[model samples]
Target: MIEATNLAYRIEKDSMGERQIPETAYYGIQTLRATENFPISGIKPLPTYIDACVLIKKATAIANSELGCIPQEIANAIVQAADEVLAGALRDQFVVDIYQAGAGTSHHMNVNEVLANRALEIIGDSKGNYQKISPNDHVNYGQSTNDVIPTAIRIGGLLAIGKTLNPALASAIATLTTKADEFQDIIKSGRTHLQDAVPVRLGDTFGAWAQILSEHQQRIQTAATDLTKLGLGGSAAGTGMNTHPQYRQRVAEILAQLINQPLQPAPNMMAAMQSMAPFVNVSSAIRNLAQDCVKISHDLRLMDSGPKTGFKEIQLPPVQPGSSIMPGKYNPVMAEMTSMVCFQVMGYDSAIALAAQAGQLELNVMMPLIAYNLIHSIEILGNTLSALTRQCILGITANSDRCLAYAEGSLALVTALNPHIGYLNAANVAKESLATGKSLRQIVLEQQLMSEEQLAKVLDLEKMSTVNG
Candidate 1:
């Protein structure tokens, strides 16, 4: 037993012993012990994840009541408590650290205890009176941490993708597509190996980014489809022990109705509880998207590099002063931030992958890590993309004069002349232009490789930059 030096307390007992829980707290002894045991990361369970667990409890309460596993009045109180939590009450009651106990038993108990205590209140009883509305006997009657945690992960992933990531991606793709159309007429120098090679439309660059993001969006959606398969009814070791015969299908059906998604029970309960492959698939998809986002962000930074000494072909909107030391310095801060967030998402993916493969014979003890990392990755990536779209992508402006200058001055213009003057002759002209500082047209005319009108027609920058021009 333990006591705070200066607070009102109530005594609660568990298998090991008894402890003094805060009188005002909805969580019971099990949760109090977990908070003491794991002071690891101060991070709490995510709200979306909390919602997932609460939704599960609500569905189970309904199922258990319907199947005569529990009294309907107790089920009503439990469901009422779940509704209150879903509507944003008792959020602070979930006090366990995200890194607690193998298989997230600590966090699971935290949820059960909170709802149980709250339900007690709704039924004219005080908190910690589990005898009347037991957290284990009623709230979590047909569930175990093994089954609950995995199902929570699936539900949380689906919710995050639907409510956050997908919408953000769609907005970003739309913004990039609009930019692509807006900049299509502007011609810029295209480079290979950091050296000028040919002319390209600035719009095509943005259009390609839009296409890449759209493709990634498709991949992520495809990956999320696997999350709909759940293992909710696989109580403790996947045997459906202590649960009603109809509990599995009934609870899944109720949860599907509550979440408004087509959630179905896994065909093999044990396999669903044992393997973390579905999470790995979604994490891998997010990682793939992050990799491409990093590339795109780098491209943006390079294109917006300098007003005096860099590409400066496009100007990212200046959201803030770039440096304290230098005035009038506006950096590509949004793109820079996008890259940083993407790198973090990639790191989370790695952690999730390791945790996914670390499962033992029956249950993976690393679920806490996987749950936190995967869902956090999705949420952060979505937020970063939304900010980038609104603050950077939408406000971008083209430097038409600079783009034209780069295009007109590039020695790659000789590329078009290759057909007219032969490859060797064109190479010689390019070499002369670089060495003598003469224009490609001037060098070509000096060599008399083609008529002036022919050179004019062949070496047109506007024609060369436009598609199929």
Candidate 2:
């Protein structure tokens, strides 16, 4: 039972929080009071943020082990405490409210206190009794919030990319590949600028999707690689003032082993500490992906227009009535969802961009926002891809009849005759066919453009489509 003394905070505003879970996690003020005290980002802690916690834990273990920076007993306690966290424990006790200012000082302190409590628990003790393992002297040895928070962020971004975002991308790429293969034989009037220009197989268009996603996957992979370069051991502005010489590489090697990913020190600690450029590059790729998704959604909406007045070449599945009042109608729900997801990813990217740009001197002032936004991008992308595969890509089926009919009716078929008869003649025949409501065959035969042999030789739809293949 701790009282709120001069914790550098005194609440003056009404609070907003509900008590759904047990109050065992926090014994101080109500959640409402705590929230009113520290109001940063409204985001709760996600497992994506666990990388930071893990790094802090491992760093603490190293700091005491090699440097003899703190007492051996305290170091052992911190290690045992961190092991509890790694083994799935004490997640809630570290609940520092998200809004606390001072460059994530609350978060750092929360972690320290939680580890200290768990360390105490390991030796059969109660929480907050830091005597056995002082949170600062043991848990947070040889590090500051600057180093720990940033390191954790890098680890989280990399992990989210590897585990969630990468798989979603792979699935999306696979789906696109399948669509490209399926649509390969389907030739339609390919449009440029909302107007029909030439013939292209539907498969070719889908292939572009596959290839585009593949490109994004490449960029994402590259970005992931860049992110592997970390800023650990650069305690307090890259000078390593209080840290031992071997601390950086040793702890980093341990982290690499623990996370099963290659993590190395930044080649230039000064550059890394002063610049958020890597995140900027990554956020740019994320923005590109969002833009690509938006374009794809728009294309889908255009392709699967109306059954009565629009393109009608493709019919999207009718999942529900498009309008509440209208009985027979369908809307592009999947496409709209894709668009919304793209909008969200784009927004997150923008947040990252702004945050990255704000870095000055030795650190960026917006670390919390940076973590929140980048994580948002990763989560939105992961869920969006899942939705895309289940609701849109997998749900789609080609309208063979309509696709063929549109191909057959289009005057763009004049392309087949362009080789033998020339463009002007084909254009005239198309104009006559439209004028008299006659088929291209009727106009050709009546005007004596070519006989059966000549027409058959030149007007092969299969051959014409194969050129664009």
Candidate 3:
């Protein structure tokens, strides 16, 4: 029997025409089964997204150049076919089972086969004619499962940042920045352990939000940069055995150009091919970003808690009917969803760590699960940012009356008064205000702590919000 493993898994043009796989045929049915089988956390990675599309194309090209390892011509055929698919051709033929043992090797071949058949149609040849190109031989010459999966994932992560994550984060930060500038003078209560603690400007609160997101962006970007270290040069393991030495660099260069993303050879091909630590690092970065997101969302929801029943410092846009039966009721629905996304990202991170831990040498064959987890986390993060930007941040409007009201009554005002009157006296003023049903202003005035004019000037909101001032 001829071993086609080393050749690109291509179906060349034979006199006998080939058969086209139906969308509802074995492949599609298997995809369904595999998806169901990996229902570990109910996380279905968004394979239909642009990032996935670009990744498949780039990997296909890489596999084709490394064609001898699999099937060089098959790789070429897959590249040709996938290019068309990426260019808006042939949608149904790629229906394949996703739960193969060797990372996404089967899925990758399915793509090649589908594309090759589609390409044949483009050239007026019947489908399944194994004469010209096969999926394994031409398409996956020098590549192995160890190399292609990581490369696809890295590019996908980069694309997520460039196209999705950064845009949403920019909008969120922009909203907070604008609010910070606007509320620079608005003094309000700061809290520790959910208790009123000190005087703080509302603007300062927003400035902190902007800073957190900025820091998250930086951290995730760095982590994603680590992912750019490609395993393409590390065939099977790190030795590049059974592959041309130049094939590694050549494939990497070609893929980098094709994907329009800068990529470099992994410093240690062995490490890149052996374990899933890079994924763990990237997932950790995503989780960190998610944690920051949860913090912001929680704070915003608290600030907009209630007009009468709670401390209403800000107002959020009501996207849905918050209450099932209550009248005139609204909630921070977007914030709640954002919080959920953060939690999901955290879960994905844990999955990454666990999966990485299970890898034993020369390869981590848990490709299907690992890729799914990473891509799912990235997708949720992108969607969450979009939600926060459009449904929450942009929709948010200031509740000036509520803010001022809360500020007037808060014991936190005692902080500013303390600098002038001492902590004990300020505390007494706050305690007395609560007892007498009087505002902080009234207590201050009644206690003869300072003249009204002096209080007004010192209570200026803008001055409270400035960091340098």
Cα lDDT over the full model 3: 0.68
Poorest 10 consecutive residues of model 1 by lDDT? 1-10
The sequence of per-residue lDDT tens digits that candidate 3 reaches over residues 351-466 is: 77887787776777777667777877877797788878888877666676666665655677667777888889988888887798887788788889899998987776556535
By TM-score, who's the top model here? 1
User: By lDDT, who's the top model here?
Assistant: 1
Model 3, runs deviating above 4 Å: 1-45, 48-77, 96-102, 122-124, 417-433, 436-465
lDDT (Cα, tens digit) per residue for candidate 2, span 397-421: 6776666666667777777778777
CA-lDDT, candidates in order: 0.93, 0.71, 0.68
> lDDT: which is higher, 1 or 2?
1
In model 1, which regions exceed 4 Å deviation? Answer: 1-6
**Which 10-residue window of candidate 3 scores lowest in summed lDDT?**
1-10
By lDDT, the candidates rank as 1, 2, 3
What global local distance difference test value does model 1 have?
0.93
Error of 2 at 291 (Å): 1.2
